[model samples]
Target chain A: MNVAVCVKQIPDSEPPALDPQHHTLVRDGKLVMDESDSFGVEMGLQLVEAAGGGEVVLVSMAPCGETRGLRTALATGAAKAILVSDPVLAGSDALGTAKVLAAVIRRLGPDLVLAGTESTDGYTGTTPVQVAELLGWPSVSFARHVEISHRALRVKRQTETGYEEVTCPLPAVVTVTAGVVEPRYPSFKGLAAAKSKPVEELTVVELGLDPSQVGFSGARQQVISVRAVKAREAGEIVVDAGEAHERVISFLEQLKIL
Target chain B: MDKTWVLAEQRDGTPAGIVLELVTAARGFGSVVEAVTWGPGGAGAAAVLGRYGVTKLYNLGDIGESLPGPKVAAAIAAQLAAESRPDAILIGATHDGRDIAARLSARLDLPVLANVVGMDASGGRLTSEHSIFGGSTVVRAEFTGAVPGLFIVQAKSFAAEAAEAAEQRSLEIVEVEVPDTGPSDAARVVTRHEEEHSGPKLDEATVVVSGGRGLGSPGNYALITELAQLLNGAPGASRAVVDAGWAPYAFQVGQTGKTVKPVVYIACGISGATLHVVGMRAAQYIIAVNKDREAPIFAIADLGVVGDVTKVIPRLIEAIRARR
Candidate 1:
């Protein structure tokens, strides 16, 4: 049960930064494995572990050819990683990012592909499904639980009404939602071993992906503009009095329907 | 014909609330508003949708009472591949809607602007305004294509209103062509359960009370829910609590979860993480109770109480009951 997990190295920011030239996320600064992708990595590692023998591989695209984010996942039991770093991959939209991931994944030829439902930064929530399409595989998105069998995978797909048990054959894509499983923290021994693990770095050319088909030129959607969210103007701050609950009641009463 | 189409979601033979809302929102795009629906119960929804200015309806016929994701996606692609393409296709930001949009975007090779709050076409092109970064900022995106723009608008992004009797028009039901063999044939729901949640849904509730990691454990989450029940509000959880398995994902309200804007929101045991703030900042009135005085939630809280939720929530519930 070889698994490939798609991870994104996103900037760690209170409010994310944008590259002025590209009007996209500024990725040159400190990068961490996107919190969302951690679940996918954790899920992949567990699936491989449950299968008794196989490897968990991570795939990520970042600027500066940074391995910081990849190291974090590698520490959490991923056998190795594939980093696709190039100036040409910058400003790639969801679809372009999916293309890069799908290409790298094809090389690994993993039996299953896993990804986060959406990244916290861009939050387009489309890349996983796009990767499935690019690979011509069935996708089960918003999965809270997935049981992988020898020949098939059953997913507890989340929905507004609750969950649906959806099954698909092997070689499928599944996107795990947040808190699907508690991600394991990298242990001291795991961290030390990760330092020596092999991380295969590749370029678009190596993956047979056209550079022009990615980055700013390949992007279907344009930012057009980026602006800060209007600061939520603070209204009132009250220290808790002994009768603070009364204050809340009075506040509701002021609305006249309380 | 010149038109825009809306995917009308339905339940139990009646249109889902989002369908009527999308119909009202679709009115902004064009006058010849059409609708498409799958399965057998769509006929009952046609008149309701017509009241909201849907002039034509595309029925994909019966596929039973299940979410036929691939079948619906292929059907819509077949429609788009017809002699004429619509100006735009609007779908709600629901789970099934996202699934459909993802598949159609792949099958049709079209771009889908998702989580859209609003859209307009003034400069000879349609641009969607997305409320990103937790609705703090807005990004306006224009579809490059000449026609058949795809957008998955968030629920309640627009107000739903009834068209005047004179404005109401008859809708034409056109049969749609669905692929005879597809993913739906093999997929079946083995078991399904709607969570037995009390009060309204966190997204739909007029009042929402939420908890966070500060709640300590799954047992403590009950305090948040109890207060919510007292207020007749929905109980929501921050991503931390939801991710910690303290509460169900459906209870999560954050950037990654559902976006909720209730009349009044009560945050208990929450540190006011930025992601959590984005989802609930739209509330008309916010009351945050955290032991940490400097929790970021205070910045946005209309009234901030620096205290322990364990101590405050019980008292607050008592206060409400006493007042009643």
Candidate 2:
């Protein structure tokens, strides 16, 4: 079995301040791999472990030096790391991003691919399905559990109501949710081993991707402007304990709730 | 002149609420809006679309008897390609909608904008509006590439238009031969488990009363339910409350759960995490009651009551009953 886990480096959700001018993430120079993607990495590792003998490949598309995230995946038991980096790949939207990933996966030729349900930064929740469509492969989103046999993959998908079990053949894509598996922390020994493992760097040109087929120019959607939400004016806090009871009654009556 | 298409979702023969909302939005862009439905035969799906002012309705008959994600997307994509080229296409931002929209975008080789709150078209370009950074910021986006721009509109962002009485006219239902997609070979729907509680759904409720970890345990959820009943609303919980087994997953509201846009959202014990706020920030009015005055929720709340939820909720419910 060959498993490929797609990871993305996103701005922390609780950023101190998103750059008001550029509409780009003002990381304060602090960047980390998306937490949800870590769950996918763990799921890939579990599948390989269950199969007894297989390769878990960690694939990521970030700036050249940002392979720190890929190295971190190697620390979590990924056998190898593949980084797709290029200067022209900046500011790519979901579609452009998926196109790059699909091209890379086509070259790698993996039996199964895993990705997080959504990236923390984009939050579009469309990458996995897009990649599957481009690859002409079956895709299952919001999967909570997955069991792979020789030629079949059984998965339990989390829906609005409950869970749905579905089985698909190999050469499929599965987008996992956070509750699927607990991600493991890098141990001292694992960290040492990761430093010695091989991490391959491939440029867009080296990967045989046409420059015209990637980045914001190739992206179909463009963001015109981004502005912070307007703050609301503070209302009076009913502090009087004796009058608090009466105030509550009056408030509910005013709103017509009573 | 090019027009826009709205892929209206229907259940049990009737168009869903968000379909009318999307129609109302498409009309704002000065484009001819077309409603398309795919379902079982004799479903009366087209008649329901007429009530929402859907001028052109396409009912793809019995393409495998069941409308799975991939088959429906492929059928619609093929239909659009054969017909007049649309300037933009909109879909509801539901679980099924997201899946189909991504596939459709790929099949059509178009760029997709997901979770759009609003849109505008000018000079042969469509600009979409989205709420990002946990609803703390709003962004306007457009595609500089080509026509038939694709987007998925967020549910509950726009109000559904009321049905108006109009003369009934016969609509042409174009049936397309959808290839045998083989049961979504991608993913299958196994079972749907309904929550035990029979209260109103949190997303559709006009008022929602929610509790957080401060509620202590599952036993104290009754207080939250009592307050919801008093207000004729629904009961909701934070992710922490759901993870602690105090509430079913259906009642949880946040980035991971359902996003709600209610008239009033009352928080009992929640500390107002950004993840939780994104789900409820669209509420018309917010009321936060917590012991800590500095809780993050107070910043976005219209009314803040600084006190323990156990003490405040009971008194608040009693006060409402007395007023009644």
Candidate 3:
């Protein structure tokens, strides 16, 4: 079955730098594939391989029309990609992102859609389900294991306690949990092939979306203030010196944990 | 704010721990607090919910084996369409909670403020505070459109306390009629496999011992569980360890994993990535043991120990055993 995987190209940083004036993340810089999306890409590739027919399609949104991250995923094995990059889409919230992605998926009409449980940077963890809802399709989130057969999907969904085997019909959305499958490293031939792969770019207007409904203009929330949290003061730090265990014992004793 | 709603999720015929926490937070909005619950536990949880300031409760009845996301969202949407809208809806940031919130937001064409850690209803408006960059920065945001703003609150963001209602009035439990959500409700659970865990629940434990990549290998994780067992605590793991297949995702503690607030948290070989730090920095006391003294974990750790986890964990385990 054809799979449309939602990939996010986020700023690569330990803690992403924030825009001082806007109180939002600075996304105009170099972008890379979010590590979390790698799992989804790998899962999609495997699903396509198992299906033995349809191809994997990458769907993503990035500011400044950057495709550097999409190329990384393309190198892994996706047939092609659809990138939605526009100045108007700069301050899009989860809902707006979902709107764009849902529109793209609707156009492709893939048998199944895949996404990460959450992005490492934004981490809203809401976009996949939002896309599913907007498309009027069933969604299964936090899937650790997924299998498709006879035009149906079975997923091992993660919960607080363990996992539940969930079944949904075709044309559904499933968000894969990180590390559920090992992502394959791009081979040298694959890397060379990615450069020649097709990437179709689209804009909000081209997608028939209202300007007032897809970006900073369409944002429903405002960041009022941003401030640094009071750093936690460090307590006693002791070297091992063959006596570190005593310190832990004494500390726990003081807390009555011992 | 005239009214607020809390989505009540239950486990084993009892409300989830975050249900009351959401109710407690709803009370702070100075509105008529109402709760919505699905399946078997609403009737049983009403009195306790009332004790925590929920004035009304809505039961959508049982949903059989169908997933709760679509049906629950449709039921709540029906209530909104049939009755007056509330000022806000509070949902826990759990697996099902996110699903319901996303569907509800899409159905209503409204935006949801997620990952909320704190909120204030000052000056006749509600603003939410989100802990970002691994608890290093707090961002306050507010919705600009539509009534009944949706907030997916993080667990342990508020203390759950029980208190009698201000007035001695009986709680009104309303039975909500669910609407057909069509194919959206097609996902069904066929089987369940709950992992067998022996100690206290990870998020509820008074003490938590988490291991990371610093443990070197999966076998070394035994030291973590051993230490936790000796201390009557729970075992946790950083995202790295979980991703490395050293532990289950249920044991993962990070921004995308479980948020824990134990009294004491011991980190073995953890480097304290920002994603992992946000989950446990709320613990009352933190101790980090790493061979690299410059690990970011040391910056926030209440007690930092410079030593190899494989070597130091065994020593600490022996000492604690001797004390007992």
Number of the top lDDT candidate: 3
Q: Chain A only: give the TM-score of model 3.
A: 0.97
Clashes of each: 2, 1, 0
In Å, residue B197's CA in model 3 sits off its true spot by 1.8
- Stretches off by above 4 angstroms in model 3 are A13-15, B165-168
Candidate 3 similarity to native, TM-score: 0.98
The local distance difference test score of each candidate is 0.80, 0.76, 0.91
* DockQ for the candidates, in order: 0.56, 0.53, 0.83
lDDT of 1 by residue, B1-324 (tens): 257789987865698777788888778665478888987787778888889998888888787544566778888877777757888888887877777777777667677788788777665467788876656678777765445777888776787897889979988888887875343334455777677586787778988989987777789898888888887889999888877878887888877677787999888888888778777887888988888888888888888887767777778888777777
lDDT of 2 at A117: 87
Off by over 4 Å in 1: B64-67, B180-187
lDDT tens digits by residue: candidate 3, B1-324: 899999999854588999989888878777888999998766787878878888788999888888889999999999999899999999999999999999999999899899999999977799999998778789999998988999999999998887554642467899988898998889999998988589899999999999999999999999999999999999999988987889888899988788999999999999998889989999999999999988999998988999999999999998878766
By the lDDT metric, which is better: model 1 or model 2?
1
Residue pairs clashing in model 2 are A222-B142
> Which candidate wins on TM-score?
3
- Candidate 1: lDDT of A197? 94
Candidate 3: CAPRI quality band: high
lDDT of 3 at B97: 97
